[model samples]
Structure formats: structure tokens, C-alpha cells
Target: MENNTFPLYFNLTMFLNLGSFRYPTFVLCFLLYVFIVSANAVIIMVITREKNLHEPMYLFIVCLCLNSIYGSTGFFTRFLRDLLSDSHLISRWACFTQVYVIYTYASYELTILGIMAYDRYVAVCQPLHYHSRISLRVVYRLVALAVIYPAFSVFTCVYLSARLPLCGNEIPKVFCANWPIVKLSCVPTGLNNLVGMLVSTTTVFLPLLFVLYTYLRIVLVCRKKSSEYKSRVIQSCLPHIVTFVNYSITVFCDVSLSRINVEELNPFLGVILSLEFVVIPPILNPLVYGLKLPKIRKVVFKMLSCLKRCH
Candidate 1:
């Protein structure tokens, strides 16, 4: 009860009753966190160092990788800390911070994917205007919008949730998420739920809709083009589509798991669902790009050859 003196901290009840399994879970998650960080970091480093990769597509890929790192850090570090500690409580401020970072990262990923879709649309549809339209300056603004728009919306939701009086302190999930936090409110959460829905639609799905539209047009154009043109589109656009599909499915699972009763679900299933977003996308994006994008793949191969020669 002494801990009650700090009303701002909330108990994370997801790991309760794990007993001996927590140790192995901790080790598995720690290694995964390391892999996610290192993999994303390598992609970012490769993008930055390769002068030829300064174009819009590669730059957008850089933003995606950066978002993965940002989002993963927000979750994994706290998860690791809680794994080692007997207590799994987070200060309200830290919870809100995680909510902001993780949600913003998700929104940013969608926005960047949309931008990349548009970039490809222009590149394939209006090849002559591609250089003029998606210039370096334009890429800068797209990246800024991806970051700023999500931050503003998420900040609004978090700010609203923070002002609410909480009736509960035990969050059922492993890490802090906005929906779980909203469910803890003592007062009427109609306003919070409304704002949450509004922000979720505006920041996440609207961009997704835009991506769908752009890709539709892209598909139409590809239908009329030569085999070589189609090949080019497949080469360039497939990675984005793969990344988007993988992220969408994992996010759906995460949201579904959070809304349902954790008591009914198996603990292992719950853990996997909770970690789907943090684990899958961060590790998957780099692999998709590294293997799919020719320029990046070429650079990776050249580096591997150089290392081989050195040995």
C-alpha cells in the first residue's frame, strides 16, 4: 500500500503468474530486441552512407526504418526492464510517453508507405515529371508531415487521457498502450473514445486509403505498359506492398488482442499478440528492403564481398 502514495504509477499485470517462464521469456525477448535494433540500424546506416540512395524512395525507406527503431525502443526497453524487476509498474508519464511514441510510429509508417506509393505512382505514371515532383525538398516535407501529424494527434489523445481520473492501475497488457490506458479511466470516457477514434482514422487509415488509391492507379498503368515496365514496377513496389501487408496484419492482431479479455486467452498467445507489432515489423522491414531493393541489395553484396576478401 505504500506504493499507493504515488498514484501516478500503474501496475502492469500481464506478466503475473508466469513464474519460471518469465526468465526464458526475458532472454528470448532481449535477443529479439537486440536483433530489431541492430537490423534497423544497419538499414539506416546503409541508406545514409550510400550517396546514390539519396532519392525519394530510399529516403522514405530510411524513415520507415527509423520509425521501427523509435517504436521498438519505446516498447522493448521498458519490457526488458520489467522482465528483470520484480515489479512491473510504470509511472503515468512513462506510460503516456510510450503511447505517444508507439502510436505515432505506427501512423508514421502508414504515412510513409502512402508517400512511397505516390512516389512510385509518379515515377511510373509520369516518368518525366518524377524528378521535378518528388525532389529532395519534397521528400523532406513528406517525412516531416509523417512525424508531425501523428505526433499532434497522439499528443491530443494522450493529453485527454492524462486528465481523466483513473479508477484502476493494473494495465492488462505487457507495455503501455493508449486503448488499455483509456479503459482504466474512472470517469466517462466518451470524449476520450471519440478523440481516439477520430485520431486513429485521420492519422492511420486515411493515409492507408491514399496508398490504396495510388496503388490502384499504379495497377491500371502497369496493365497498359510493356513487360519491362511491369517488371520495374514489380521490383520497386513489391517491397512496399509486402511491408504494408505484414504491418497491417500484425496491427490488426495487436488491436484485437488488446480489446478482448486476456483471461480467456492463453498466456503465450497473449504475449505473442502483444509483441506482434514491436517484433514483426521492425525485423521484417529491413529484410524486405535489403533483399528486394536492387540498390540496397547491391550495396550489401558488395560489402559482403569486401569482408570476404579481407578474411
Candidate 2:
């Protein structure tokens, strides 16, 4: 961290270690996190309350909303603590908590995306087989995978990767992330680094690759399909394309962290990098799909009217 601030809610027994100018930026980021939370919350409600949206696609979307809400909130909570504090010192436990949360939710989000991509693949590539292959039981199981796999994956990574003891905590990144946490520990974190990075690749790339391949195949089919289904397929696939692009960039940023020194990273670049992962995709995916698909928009309007009347 460029400047110093106390980890919010510090009990005054720990050393604080940030530089001077980081707090204000953290504050601004905090505000943006608040907006993200609010926006995603409304997205979840809209998807859930609107009866017409109770389909597999929208169900996956609602799952995305929940994942984004979880991931972003975990990150911003730590950011909030730092933003409110005047020093950069964070306790070992606090740092671990942040890392665990952010990693778990991120892993969860990636898993969800993979499941969604599979859903789309079935819908588009195997239309006749889609209903049989992707029954309610299967969607429910996919949802379960999205929810449960993160716990298993994150726990495995946290357990297997972080065995070293922390000597002095000068955590490199402003926020606590797995690689950064490994770097902070004085004990040789080389193995941890390698394993952690690999885990990250698995968390990120597996779903990402599936999504890419799924979409690519979908695009091919779209070209061959009747013009009637083309528009809807194109509209649906665009959102996933946008979402995948965002994920690719974010995974790039994270993987790059292992190779670069955080101190040398540019400040403005840092803010944008952090924001890009959650803020960009959730906002863009909904906008791209909801706006392009007239049916979702129409349903949204009807739902809004119903809400208005209820109020």
C-alpha cells in the first residue's frame, strides 16, 4: 500500500503499515463497491420476483448475480476497513479472512459460469436433446455445484497452499489475495505460489475455456440455424461473450500478479483492474442480454409495473 491506514475495527494491538495517499482512493473505491452491492441486489430480486423469468437461462443469471454480490461484497468489506482506517496495518487473521472470502466467491463464480455455459451449450447445440439433458433435476444439481464446489476448492487451496508461517506482515497488495498473502509470509512460499497459481488457473480457466468453446460452437450453429432462432441466439450469446471477455481480463490481471511486484503497479491501473472483474461483467451481462432480448425487457416492464402497484 502506498500509504498507511488502520485496518477498520483493529483492536489497537497490531502494527499498521500503509503509505500516506492510499486512504482517499480506498474511500472512493468503497463508494463504488456500495453501488455494486445495491445494483446486484436489485438484479437478484428482479430475477427472482418476476415469475416469467423462471427459466434455466434466467436461473443461471440469478446465480451470477448472487455470486457477484458475494464476491464483490467480500472484497469491498476489506476495502472498507482499509478506507476507514488511517493506517495500513492488518492482522494476520484479518488478512486470511479476506483472502479466504475473496477466493471462495471467485471460485464459486467461475464454477457458476461454467455451468451456465454448459446450459447454453445444451440449449443451442443440442436443442432437441436439451430438455431431456437439462431437466430441472440437472439444473438444480448444477446450482448445487455452483454453491458447493467453491467451499471444496477454496478449502483445498487454502489448506494445501498456505502452510508457511508469517514472519512480518508487509502484504504486497493493497488488498489480501492468495498469491499476495503467500508472498507476505517470510517462509519460502515458492511451492505455495506455484500450487496457488495453478489452482487459480483451474478456477478461472476451466469454466472460461468451456464458455469459450460453448459459445464458439453456438456461433457456428447460429450461422447454420434458421433466421428465426438467429436473433435470439445471437442476443443470448452476446452477453456470455461480454462476460467471458471480462473474466479473461480479470484472470489475466490475477495471474500477472504472481509475476509482478505490486509496488511497481500503477495506481489508476489498480483501481480499474479491481473494478473490472465484478463491476464490469454484472452490469454489462444484464444490459447486453436484457436490452437485446425484447422479451426480457418486456417482462421487466411488466414486473416493474406490478411492483409499482404493490407499493
Candidate 3:
């Protein structure tokens, strides 16, 4: 592999075995991905558009949806491109762009979860201060963190990952992944892997730990409050818990395996990973937001009514 060669046509990734039904699978993926992305986008639109859905929880959800929009677009659109063309020889720039985009979305997700926990903590620990403290200005700052913080983290990872000389031309997974890209280094990948490990832990585990501690405090407070407050507490926690778990599995599986047995890689496993990150969460997002918050459901109905009236 030459330093400047972006092997577009020669890139044979075994991870995507386009067997007998390749077209069908691609078509299926495109349709399904479109539906899920559109569904979440609509939810975000409705939440933002509807007047009554303008609470702090809905606002945080809007942020989460914005993150999903980034993730879904980054992976789903790229997946289609890879399906259509030979994605083997990713150019240095394209590879770097992929790293930057994926990291940005991933970091936004981590920050979103942390913000959600902090939102809950404020709501629980200081019930009276919930409205005053968690205001529009505060939401803006959190959203800013969700976007900018990830950029910094991903910048560090991509900067480091790009410096390593790739060992070979082929990348195991469909698109460029952080660890997968790190594994391509010609030099000993220990340093890259060490940084990768630290980044992963700092981004994923640390926020999750804070979420846990926050929720523990929340539970204690809820227990002391009225039973009526218990359902409210549960409602706030459940959707974000689902988000946390959805993200945890993807990150865990991605980092857990160091060297992909490229020869033995299952295409379906690729499907599972892609879907977990792209499809499942988007599909679940609306349902989780709708079920967790009555205001969202009410807004949905109101939107439907307005549409019916217009028709």
C-alpha cells in the first residue's frame, strides 16, 4: 500500500458479503433506514413546532433527536454509498472525515446522556429550582457542550489515528471505525489502542458513572417524596436509560473486539452493529419519547388534528 493511494476500486471488504441477495439487502436497508430517520426527524419537528411540548424534558429530547440525526446521517448515508460502490480504498481525507464525523456524533451522544442526567438531578435534588435553574439559557449551553465537546474529543482521536501508518489497504468493517482504523497502523498499535481505550472510557464510562450516581440520589429523593413523584421520577429515567443502554452496547461491542477475524466476519453481525447504531435507536427514540412524556403524545395528536383541518 502506497502512502498516497486511495484504493477505491481495489478495496475488497469481506465484512460486507453481498451474497446472492445483495440488491435485496441494500434495498431493504435503504428503505428501513429512511423510515427510521424520517420518523425521528418528524418527532423532533413536532416537538419543536408544537407549543405545549416546550418543557425541559422535551427540550433535552430535542437535543437527543438532534444527536440521532447526526448519527443516522453519518452511518446510514455512508452505508448506502458503500453498498453501491467499492469502498475499499478510502482516501486519507475521506478516512479522516469519517473519523471526524463519527467521533462528533458519538461525543454528542455521550454529552446528551450526561446533560439528561444533570437535568434529572436538578429536577430531583432541587425540585423547586427545576424551572428556574434549567432555563432556556442553560439548555443552550448544554446543547453547545453536546456539539463542541465531542468535536474536541474526536479531534484528538482522529489526529492521533491519522498519524499512524496503516499496515494494509483493507479495513475490516464496512465504514471507517475508530478502533478499526487504529488497528490498521503499521507501527505497534499499543499506543494508539491505549489512547483509544482511554478515550472510550472517558467518553462512555465516566458519563455513565455520573448518570448512575445521579439516579441513585434521584431514587433516594423520590422515595422520600410523595408516591405521585415516583412515577414522574421513573418516567424521566426510563427513556434516557434506554438511550444509555442502546449506546453502551454499540460502544462495548465495537471496542471489546480488537482484531476482527476478517476471514470469519459475519455479514449479519455487520448488519446487527449497523442497525444497533443507526436503526434501532432511531426507531425506539420516538416510541420512548412518546411513551415517557404525555406532552409529546398530546402534541402528536394536536399536530394530527391541525393537519386534518388543513386537509
Off-target runs (Cα >4 Å) in candidate 2 are 1-31, 190-194, 303-311
Query: In candidate 3, what are the lDDT values of residues 30-110, reduced to their tens digit?
Result: 897777777678789888888877877788888788777777787777677667664346666776787688777777777
- What value does the lDDT take at residue 58 in candidate 3? 81
Q: Which structure among the candidates has the greatest TM-score?
A: 1
Q: Write the per-residue lDDT of candidate 1 for residues 1-311, one digit (tens) a residue.
A: 33343257988877756678878978998898888888888788889999988888998888899889898998888988898789988988898888888888888888888888889889988999999999999989888887888888889998998887776788888888888878876678999989989987887778778888888998998998899989988999899999988988888898798789987998878977888887899999999999999899988889889989999
Tens-digit per-residue lDDT, 136-209, candidate 2: 78889988977786677677667653455554445555566666555445556666767666776777777787
Q: What lDDT is reached at residue 42 by model 2?
A: 62
* Residue pairs of candidate 3 with colliding backbone atoms: 7-89, 11-88
TM-score computed on alpha carbons, candidate 2: 0.82
| Global fold similarity of model 3 (TM-score) | 0.88
Q: Candidate 1, residue 82: CA error in Å?
A: 1.5
